[model samples]
Target: MPRAVVRQRDARHPALPRRAPTPPWTRWAAPVLLAVTVVVQVATPRTLDLSFLLAAVPPLAALAYGPAATALLGGTVLLLLELPHYDLGHPGESDTATVAFVAALSVLFAAVRSRRDAQLVSVRTVAEAAQFAVLPPLPEHVGPVRCAGLYRAAQRGTLVGGDLFDVRRGPRGVRALVGDVQGHGLAAVGTVAALIGAFREAALDQRDLVGVAARLDRRLVIDAEDAGIAETEMAESAGDTGAAGTAGTAGAAGGAGHGEPAELFATAVLLEFAADADELRVVSCGHPPPLLLRGGTVTELAVSPGAPLGLGLAGVAPPEQTAVGLRPGDWILTVTDGVTEARDASGAFYPLTARLAALTEVRQRDPAALADAIWKDLVRFSGGVRDDVALLVFAWER
Candidate 1:
C-alpha cells in the first residue's frame, strides 16, 4: 500500500486542544508585581497608597502556580504588607490581616482547580484511547493523495458514535469507507465495529468495492439473525420457567409488540483506487453521492444508489460501481447523512455544496482546514448538529 495514515492531531487527533503555555515571564508574574508595588511605594510620595495592588499578587500567582507556590507567594505578600519599613503608610492591622486571608483563599482555590484539572485529563485520556482503539484514524496519504477524516458523535460526552469511516491500504488498492449505522450512541458501537471489521477483512483480498459491500451486508444480516435467535430463546425459557400468572404477563408483553427486532441496516459509500489506476471506483449502498472538488468547484458524483447493507440486496445483484476520473489536484469529499440531512434552526437542510463552494480555493485543499471550515460553518448554521457526523476528505497530493 502506497499510503500513510494521519490522525487528527497534526496528524494529531483524539486529544482536545490544550491551553497555550504562558510566557516564561508569567511564571514570576506575582513576584514581579510585588517588586513593582514596592518600587512605586518607596520611589513615589509615601502617600501614593498602593496597598490594594500589593494584595492582588498572590491571587494572580494562584492562576499559574500550584497550591504550595501560591501559599508561599501569599506569605511573601503578607510579610511585605506588615513589615514596618515596607509598609509605606502606617498600615492598619485589618489591611495586613485581609491580605493574609486572601492569600490563604488563593491557595485553597489553587488546590481545588488542580485536582479537578487532573481528573478531567484522566477521563479524557481514557475516552480518546477507547475511541482510537474502536475506530483507528484514516490514512493521511493514499498513494499520492492526502486523506483526512473527522467524526463527531451526536451522543453528548462520547467520542465514537454510530457513524463510521476508515481508509486502509490493501491488495486491491486503497479502499475507503464512509458509513452510518442505523442509530446513534454506544448502543450502535457494536454494529459499527462489525461493519468496519468486515470492510477491513474484505479489503485485504476482495478485488473490488462491490465485493467489500457484499461482505458488509452479509455480516450485518448474520449478526441480526443471531440476535433474533437469542431473544427468541430467552422468551421461550422465561415462559417455561415462570408461574402461569407471570408467564401470561410475559406473553402479553411480548405479543403487545416487542417480539420483532427492527431490521438492521447501514448506508455506505465505498471507494477503491485500483493499483496504477488514475481514478476512483465508487459504490453507493443507499448512501448519498460523494462531491468532487476540482478547480474550486463542487459537483456531486453521479453514482447510482442500491439497497443499503443488511437487507441482503447485494447477494441478488451487486451495487452499481462508478469509476470517476481523478485529476492531479482533485479532491473527493464524502460524508454520512448526518451531514447532508442536518437541518438548521429554520428547518432548512445544510447546504453542503454551497458551503464547500464558499471556502476559498486554497482552504479546500487541506483536509484538516476544510473539515474545520465546514464544521464551523455547520455549527453557525444549525446552532448544533443532533446526529452522528462522519466526514472524509482526500485530494491528490499537490
Candidate 2:
C-alpha cells in the first residue's frame, strides 16, 4: 500500500502517479560543471594543470543527460586533452589517455542507465494501474460535504491495503463507509474490494444506513463461503501431492485449526448525512468510536458497539444508526486501529483524544489540513507506524 497519502479538495482525477521528472539540480550541474572547469583551468597558474578535472564532466553529464549528450560532453573533453591537455599547461601522456578512456566508459554507462530507467517506468505504470483499480483515489467533495482521506500501509511498496474508505452521493444522501478487513497486506485485498463493491452499490440503492450495513454483511458471508469451497476443491484435486501435505501441515500448525470464521469479519462504521437537517446517522460495527470536533473541543461519540460484519450478525443483532446533531463548523473524524493503537517505544498507545484536544490548529484548518495534521502528529508520536493507517474527515462545506 502507499506509505502515506493525504488527498483533498478538487482532485477528481484517478490520482495517476506521473513519471518522475529529472531533478533541476542534476539537469543544470552538467553545463555548470563544464563552464567551471574551463574557468578554473584559465584562472589558476600553469603549474596547476587541471586536465584531470575534465574527465569528471562526462560522468556528471550522464547523470542527467541521455547517451548522445553524454557522448558530446566526452568529445569536448577529448578536444581539450588534444589541445595541449589544458589551457594552462600540458599533462603527462598517461594522464591524458586515462581521461579519454574514462570519458568513453561514461558514455556507455549512460546508455545502460537510460535503458534501465525506461524499463522501470514501464513496470511502475502497470503496477500503479492494478493497485489503483482495487482502491481508487477518493473524491474531493460529496454533495454539501467536503472530503479528505488518508491511507498508509504497514508494508512498503503497496498502493492499496486492507483498510478502505469511500464517500458516495446517492438518492438517500451523502453516505460514507470506513472499514478495515480482518488482516493486512495483499492477502486481504480481495476482501477489501468485495466490501467496497457492496458498499458502493448499497450506498445508492439502500434507503438507510442499516440497509447498507446489511448488504456488506451478506457480501462478506457469501464471499467467505465461496472461498472455502474453492480451497476445498484445490486441496482435494491435489490428493497425496507434496504440496497438499505441506498445506495441511501449515493449516494445522500451532493448533489454530483450519481457518476460523472470525478471520472473515471486518470492523466498519457506516454513516449517512441528512440532506434536510444538520445531523448524521452513524452505525458502528466493531469500529473505533468516531471523533466529533466542534469549535475548540473534541468529543468521541458514544456509539453503541455492534458485532463486526461477515460473522452472520445481521440476523441476531443488526447494526442501527445513531443520530448525531451537527453544527455549521463541526468536523467528524474516523480512523482505523492503526492510528488509535499506534504505540511508542514504551509500548503506550497513541493519545489521539488528548492530542486532538491540544492541537489548536486543527479547529481553524479545513478538512484537508485537519486530516494531514492528525496523520503527521500520529507518525511523530508513534516514531513510526507499523500497521495500515486509514483516516477520513468530513465537514459540511456548503
Candidate 3:
C-alpha cells in the first residue's frame, strides 16, 4: 500500500513521500521582478510610475515558498519600493500606500496557501488509511518462502493505485494474489477492495486456486449490480457525467443491469507456494505469467491464461494450474502488465525476460534483489511509466 518496499543489494522498501522542493524559477523571478520595478521607477520620472509593478513580487513568492519565505520576500519588496524614490527627496503617500497594500496582499496569499496545504495533508492521511485497511503489507516471510512486494501508482503524489497484491498463510500452505483493476482512481480502488476481499475469504473457504478466481469473479458481478443501483439513484438526484473515457466504461459496467454489459472486471494471478519449497502453483486470469529465475537462466512460466474475472461466465474450461519447479535459490516474480507494457521513448516495450536474464549474477537466489533490479531497470528503460505497477517476488530457500 505504501507503494515501496526495500529493494536490491541493499535496497529497502521505496522511500516515503516528502515535501517537494521549490522550483528554481520561483527563486529567481522574485528578485528579477524587484530589480525591474526599481529600474522602471527610476527611469520613468513621476508621470510614468512603475511602483505598481513591485506588487507582483509577493504573489509570485507566495506560489513558490512557504508562509515564512513568502513573508520575508514580501517585506523585502515593500522596503525596496521606496528606494528608487529615495534620491528624489521625500516621496508621495501614494508610494507608502502601495507598499502597505502589497504587504497585506502577501500575508493574505500566505494564509490561503497554508489552509490549502493543511487540506491536502488531511486528504492524504485518509487515503493512506484506506489503502492500509484494504491492501495491508505482505509478510516478508510466509511459510517456506521469502517474499516482498511493491506497488507504484501512475499518478504522481498518490500512494495507492489500481494495481494490488496480497499474501496469506492458510491451512493449505501460502496463497498470494496480484491483480490490476480495469481503470484508475477511486473506482479502480473500489474494485481492488472488492476483489481482494473476495480473494481473502475465498482463499480460505475454497480448497483450490481456480476456485478462488471463480469466487472473485462472482463477487465482482454482485458489486457491479450494486454500483448500477447506486448510479441509477445518483442519476435521479443529479445529472451524470457522460460516459466516454475510462470512467464512462466503468460506469457502464456497473450500471448495465441484468442482460447488459456489466463493467467491473480485473486481471489477476493466483499463486500457492508449497510448504516444502518444491514448486509454485499458478492460475492466471488474463494476467502476465510469473517469471522463473533458475540456474542462471530466467524463464516465464508456461501457465495457461483464462478470461478476466467478472464476466459472470466461467473459464470455458476450468482454469489450468501449472506448477513450476522451485529448487533452493530459485525465484518466481509475478507482475501486472504495467511492467511488460512500459514503453520507451521509441515505443518499444520493455524486454523483461532479456533484462532479467542479464541480471542473473546479481539477482540470483534473492527475491528482493531481483525485484529491485527489475524495477530500477524498467524505470531506466522506459524513461518514465504511465500506468499502475504491482510486483511480487518469492524466493525458495531451504
Candidate 4:
C-alpha cells in the first residue's frame, strides 16, 4: 500500500485523535513573557512598567489557545496585574475601567472568531454543491459507447477544478470531450460550462469534429478575454499574479497570438464514435492522448497534432481527425493528466497502462464495470488525489 493511503487509514482509526501541531512561538511566548515580567520587577523595581506587557498578552494567548482562550487569558492577566493596585486601594476607578475594557475586548474577539468559522463553513458547503452540479453522475452508456468517468480536485473542498469531461449521445453520434481550463474553482468551472454548452450545440449542428472544436474555441476565447478583465481589476486591488503561468499555458495551447492579450485556453481531447461503422475519430489539442485498451494490451491513440483551441497566434494550425478501427471486446479509455500524473506519497506516478492491463483478466466486460475497475485502481494508485481527475472508458463487447 502507498504511504499516503496507509496514513489516511491510520487517521481514520477510532483509537487515534488527530492533534494540531503546536506553533513554535506559541509554545514559548508565555514563559518568555513571564521571565521578562519577573526581570523587570527585580531589576528596575519602579513598580514595574507593565503597560507594554499587558498589551502583548492577548495576541500571544490567542496564538496559543485560539480566540476565546486568548481573551480569557488576557482578562486573567489583567485581573492579576490589577490585584496589587486593588489591595493597595490605589486608583480604584482606573482598575474598574481596565476590567471593563478587558470584557469588551474579549467579546469582540469571540464575535470575530465566530464570523470567520461561519464563513469557512459556508464556502465549503457551496463548493461541494457546485462540484456535484458540474460533475454530475456518469452515465452507464452514451449511445453505443459504454462510458465511465472519474474526477478529483487538487484542493480539499473544491469538487470541480480546471479539468472537465463530458459525454453526450446526440443525433450525429456519441461525442465526448475531456479538457482542462487555465485554473481552478469558479472561474475554471465557468469556462467549462461555456465550452460544454458550445460543444453540445455545435456537435448537433456541425457534421465535422473540427467545426465543433472551432465553434467551442471561439466562445471560450471571448469568455476568457471578458473574464481576464475582471481578474485584472481584482488582481490590481489584491496585488495578485493575474493569470500568469496557467494563463500563459492556456493561451499557448489555444494558439493565441504574440500580440493577443492573455486569455484562458484549454488542452482538450474530443472523440466521436460511430456505432454503425465501428469507427472512432479523435482530435487532440495539446491534451494527453487517450489509451485504447484491447485484449489486456493498452495502445495510446495518436493526437491529431493540433494546437490548443484558443490561441489567436499566427501560423498555428487546427487539429486533424485521426481514425481508428474498433472491434468487439475492445475498450477505449480517455483520461486527463490528473490520472496519469497522479503522484503517491513517494512521488511515484500511477501506472495507468499497467493497471488497465491487469483488468483484462476480469470476466465482466460491461462498460460500467470496466470504468469502475479503472477508477478504483486510479484511486488506489494515487492514495487519493491532490488534484481534480476525470476518466472515461468506452467498451464494445463481443
Model 3 misplaced regions, further than 4 Å: 1-61, 64-90, 232-261, 313-316
Per-model CA lDDT versus the true structure: 0.79, 0.79, 0.74, 0.66
Residue 55 local lDDT, model 1: 84
TM-scores, all candidates, are 0.69, 0.77, 0.78, 0.60
RMSD over all Cα atoms, model 2 = 4.9
lDDT of 3 by residue, 1-398 (tens): 22255232111223223233346687678778877777766676666766566778778877766678778877886566555643332346787677667767777887787778677767656666666777776677877878977777776655567988888875567899999988975558888888888888987888878888889888888888777677665653343455456556655554554233347888889999876557678998889988887777878889999888887647356577888777887778888889999999999999888887788776754666667677788889998778888898888776
Ranking by lDDT: 1, 2, 3, 4
| Range of the 10 consecutive residues with the lowest summed lDDT in candidate 4 | 1-10
Best by TM-score: 3
Candidate 4, position 67, lDDT: 61
Q: Per-residue lDDT of 293-387 in model 1, one digit per residue for the tens?
A: 88868999999898899989745667988999887878888988888888887899999999888896646447767876777777788888888
- Candidate 4, residue 304: lDDT: 64
Location of the lowest summed lDDT over 10 successive residues in candidate 3: 7-16
- Kindly report which residue pairs in candidate 2 clash with one another: 1-158, 1-159, 2-158
Greater-lDDT candidate between 3 and 4? 3
Could you tell which candidate, 1 or 2, scores higher by TM-score? 2
User: What residue runs in model 4 are displaced by over 4 Å at the alpha carbon?
Assistant: 1-130, 185-187, 231-260, 313-315, 344-346, 363-365
